[model samples]
Target chain A: MAITGVLRPGHAQIRVLDLEEGVKFYRDVLGLVDMGRDSQGRHYFKAWDERDHHSVLIRQADKTGIDLFGFKVDSEATLEKFEKDLQAYGVTTKRIPAGEMMNTGERVQFTLNNGHAIELYADKKDVGNGLGYHNPKPWGPDAERGIAPTRLDHALLAGGDLDQALDIFVNVLGFYLVEEVVAPDGMKIAVWLSCSNKTHDIAFLRHAEDGKLHHVSFWLETWEKVLRAADIMSMNDVPVDIGPTRHGITRGATIYAWDRSGNRFETFSGGYPAYPDHAVITWPVEHLPEGLDYAQRKLHETFLTVFS
Target chain B: METQKGNTTSVMTEEAYEYVKITIAETGESFDCSTNESVLEGMRRLGKRGIPVGCRSGGCSVCKCQVVKGEYHQHRPMSTEYISKQELEENCVLTCCIKPKDNLEVKVIGKMHKNVCEK
Candidate 1:
C-alpha cells in the first residue's frame, strides 16, 4: 500500500557499437535472458529473475549511450494522472502505442531539461521467473549462466542542469531526494532520487555534457558477490572502472566495469533503506571522494570526467 | 605417462599441459581436465554444462570453485574484495583463472543466483 504511483525503474534502451557482440556479452557474460529480436532489429533481454518481458534493449549504432529510460507505474489511471501532471507542470509529453515495445502496453515519454529521455508505462506482460509460484526451486539454469544479475537497478546520468532535473523528478514525478553532494557555494553537484524505498532509483550529476550516462547498475546479492563480480571482470578482462569498494553515500559495496562498447555498469550490494520522512544526507563537494569511494577517500579523476 | 609439477609440463611452455581430474560435487560428475586451459575451459571441452560462466577472461566470478584435495595456481590475481585472502586460503578459486598444478578434486562452491530487486 505504501507504493502506489511509480513502482520501479522498468527499462532502458541503450545503443551499442555492435549488436551481435553486445548480445553475446549480455547473454553469456552478463547472464541476461535474450528474449529475441524484433523487426526493428533491436535485441531485448530480461534478467533471469525479472517478471517483466525485458528491462534492457540494445541496438547497434555508431555511438554508445542511453536512448531513454522508463519506469513502470501502478496502473493506467496512474499513467494518465502522471501525463496530466507533466503537462500541468509545463513539460511536453507524447504517447507511444502499446505495442511499440514487445508485450508492453503504452508509454508517455518526455525529455527532461537536462535532455535525458524518460518514460512511464502502465503495462508489460510478466513472464514468470521459470520458478512457478507454488513449490519453486531457488533458481533454474539461466541463474548460473553468466554474471547473472537479478535485475536492472538504477542509473547515474550526467547533465548540465542537475537542479532542474532534480526538480522534475522530485516535484513532478513524486520522487524523494535521498542524498546529494553540494558545492561549498551551496549548489548541488550531484543528487540521488528515489521513487520507492531501496536507496536511489536514479541519480544525476553536474557535467558539461548533457544526457550522458555515467553507469547502469545491476544488483549483486552480497558484498561477496560484488567481489566475485570483480573476479569475473578480471577473468574476462573487462576494464574495471572502480571498486570492489564501498560507497559512503548509499553504503553499497560496488565494482564498476565497462562492457565492450564502453558503457559502464555496476555490480553492487547493500544500501540502507530510506523512507520519505527520512532526512536527506548532504556531502560537501570537497567530501565527494568519501561519498563516491569511502575506503579510498580519493576522487577518481576518471569517475568525474568519464561518461558514455 | 603423466607430467609432474615442479618440472616443465611439456616441450613448449606456452602450450604446456597438465592433466587433472575434476568432480562436480553437486551432480557427482567426474572428468579429466588439463592445465593448458582453465577448469572452466576443460568443462566446456568435455561438454559439462553446469558451472556458470562470465567474462571468460576472469573479471567476473560466475565460475568460482573450490579445491577439495589438490593444488592449483591462479594464473591471474583474484580480487580479495570478492574472495578474501582467507577464502583463497580455504581453497576457493575462480575456475576461469584456475590452472591445475596437481591431480585435483574441485567443488563448485559459489552460492549465487538470480534475485528479485537485485539488478
Candidate 2:
C-alpha cells in the first residue's frame, strides 16, 4: 500500500521498419501475447503473466526507436494531482483522450529535458492473465512458449542532461534513486530509479544525443530462462549485443538483443529487490568495466555508443 | 545457374553481374561484393566482423562509414542527424543502405568502429 503514484512501467511504443516482421519476432520469438492491431495500425502485446491489456506497442515507420514510454498510476486522482504538480514544477503536460490507444485511459504526456516522451495513466482494461479469479491456474500455454518473459521490467534510455531528467523522476514522480554510476568528474553518468520493490523501474545513461534508446528490458523467472533466451536468439539468428552474463550494477542476469527493426530489448532476471529505505548503490567510472560485465570484466564499446 | 565455385555461391546466374573487391581501409581486410548487393550485406556474408550489423536498413546509423575511395549507390536515405550535408557530401553513408557501384575502399566510422579496428 505504500507504493502509490507511478506504480510501474505500463507500456512502451516502439517504431519498427516493417510491421509484419516485427509482429513475427515479438509474438513468435519473444513470446509476448499478441493483443491485435489498432485502428492506427499499431500492434499491441503483453507478457503472458501481465493482467493489463497490453504493455508493448509497435508501429511501422521510417525510423527505429521508441516513441514513448508510459507508467501506470494508482488512481485517476493521483494522475490529475501529478499533472498539476508537474505543471507547478514548470513541466507541461498534455491530455491524450481515452481510447486513443485502445483499452488505455487518457494519458498525461510530457517531454523530459532529454527529449523522451513520458506518459502517466490510471486506467487500462485488465484482461486477466488467462486465469480466472477463483482457484486460478499458475500458468498457461503462453508461459511455455518461446523466450516467454513474465513482464515488461524496465528501460534504459540514453540522452544528454541526464541529471535534470533524474531530478524530475525522483522529485516529481515519487521514484527514489536506487543506484547510480558516477563519472571521473563526480557527475552521475548513469542512474537507476525505482517506484516499487524492483531494482529499477526506469534508468538513464548520459549521452551526446537526446531521445536515444538503450534497451527495453523484460523480466524472466530465472538464470536458466536467460540462457534459454540466448538459445532462442541463436535459433532465430537474432543479433545479440552482449550478455548471457551478469551485470555488476544491478546483479541482473541478462542478454541484450535487437529486434528486426534494430530496437534493443533485454531478457533479464535476478536483481536485488530495492526498497525506499535502502541507500543508493554507487559505481565509479573507474570500476565501470566490472560494474557492467562482472563475468567478463570488460566494458563493451557498443554498449556505450550503439543506441537506437 | 547456381554454381558452387569452392565456398562462394554465385547467385548471379540470370543477370550478368560482377563482383567488386571492397577493401576495409581501417583493418586492411578485403572481400568480394556483388554490384547488386549492399556493402554491409557483402561484408556480413563474409562471416567476419568487418562492420557491425545494424538495422540492415538506413535507420540505425550503426553501420555508418566513410567512402574513402569508392563508388556506391545509396538506395535508402540516411538519417540527417547522423549524416549531415557535409558528411553526405564527403560520401558518408550507412553501409547497409549503399550498394557498391565499383571496386571500393571504406573507413569504418560507425559507433562500433573500435570493435573492428581495435580487434
Candidate 3:
C-alpha cells in the first residue's frame, strides 16, 4: 500500500459547554453514530462509515476547544518509530497508557509549537459499520440519518509558528504539502498538508493566537450532500459562518457552521485526489478572497477573526 | 365587543414583554433587548450588527463586552479563562449570556472588537 504510516484522523476530543446539548447536536444534527458515554462522563461518536470504536469525543468544560487530535498509525512498530523520530527531531513526547480512553491503545502525545496537542496511536477496537464485510450492503439505516457524512475529513488549525509546526508534520510525520496561500512578501498565510490520497488531512493558518481551531470538516459523498447540510443547519438555527459554496483552494464544496458550543464544523465534498508526486498549488494573499469562497469571491470577515 | 377584546390582547402582550434599550458605547448604536433573551440574541433578531455573533451560549467567549453604564443580569458563568471574577464584578460579561435589566451602554472587548467598534 502507498500509505503505510499515519493512516488517517482517528479521533478528536472536543469540549462543550453543556454535555446533553452537545450530544443532541452531534448525534441528531451532525449525524454521527453514538458510541455511548464513558466513565468520565465523556461521550463518544463515530461517523457512519468509520470502522473504529469512536472518532469524536465530547466532555463538559468551562472553556471550549479541541482537547487533542489523534491519528491512527499502521502498527505498534510505526507508532514506536514515530515516537523515537519525534524525540530525535528535538520534540519531547509523552506516552499515555492504554485504557486511558476506552478501547484505545497507548498513545504517543506531544505538544506542537502552537500550543495544540497531537497524538499518534496504533490500536483501537474495530467496530464494523453495520454492513458486514462479506456480502456487505451498499448502505444502512445510519446512512439516512441527518446530514450523515461518510468520514471525518480534515481540520484547519490557526496559530503562530506555522513554520516550526510544518516541520513536525512534514519531516517527522510523513505528511506532504498539498496546497498553500502565500502573502505578497512570500510569507505563507496558510498551508494544507496530506498524509494520504485526500487533498488535505490537516491545514494550518498563521494567526496571533495559539491553539486556535478554524474548523474540523467531515466528508460527504457529493455536492448535493453539502447542500442538504445547509438545509439542516438552517432548520436547526445553526450559526453558519460561510459556504454552501466552493473553495478555490481544494475545489471542495463546503459549509462552515458552529456547534451549540461555538466550535466550528464543516460538511463538504469534492476535491481532486492528491498524490505525493503532485505539485503543490499556491495562491497569493490577494486571491485569498476567491480562494476561501470561490463562488462568492468574498473573503468573509468572520473567517479571519472569529475562532473558539 | 371585538374591538375591546383586541385592545385587551394587545395590552396583555405588551405587559408580558419587558424590553430594555441597550446602547453601544463606541458606535452609539442602540437596540431594544428583551429580559428573556441574551443581548446577542436581541442584537441578531434586530439585525443590529453591533457585536460579532458567537455561540449564543457562555462557551466561546467571542461576544465578550463590558457594560460601561447601567446594569444587567448574568444568566450564566463566564469562564475565568476569558473574564476573571474581578472583571465580572466590573460589569465585564459575555453578551451571549447576559440580559439587560435596565438601559445599558456596553463596549465590545473580545477578539473581534475592531469589527464592531471600528465599523
Candidate 2 ranges with C-alpha deviation above 4 Å: B1-20, B32-59, B66-92, B97-104, B111-119
Residue A128's lDDT within candidate 1 is 81
Superposed by TM-score, candidate 2 places the C-alpha of residue A74 at a distance from the truth, in angstroms, of 0.4
Best by TM-score: 3
Using TM-score as the measure, name the better of candidate 2 and candidate 3.
3
lDDT of 1 at A132: 85
Best-first order by lDDT:
2, 3, 1
Worst 10 residues of 3 chain A by lDDT: A232-241
Off by over 4 Å in 3: B1-16, B76-79, B112-119
Instruction: Evaluate chain B of model 3: give its TM-score.
Output: 0.77
lDDT of each: 0.78, 0.85, 0.84
Per-prediction DockQ: 0.02, 0.17, 0.20
Q: What global local distance difference test value does model 2 have?
A: 0.85
What is candidate 3's CA lDDT for residue A125?
Answer: 97
What digit string (tens of lDDT, one per residue) describes model 2 on residues B39-112? 88788877867777665545567788888897888755554545666777778778876878899998888875
Error of 2 at A112 (Å): 0.3
Candidate 1, residues A98-179, lDDT tens digits: the string is 9989999999999987879999999999888889889999999987777888889999989899988898899888999999
Each model's TM-score, in the order given? 0.73, 0.87, 0.91
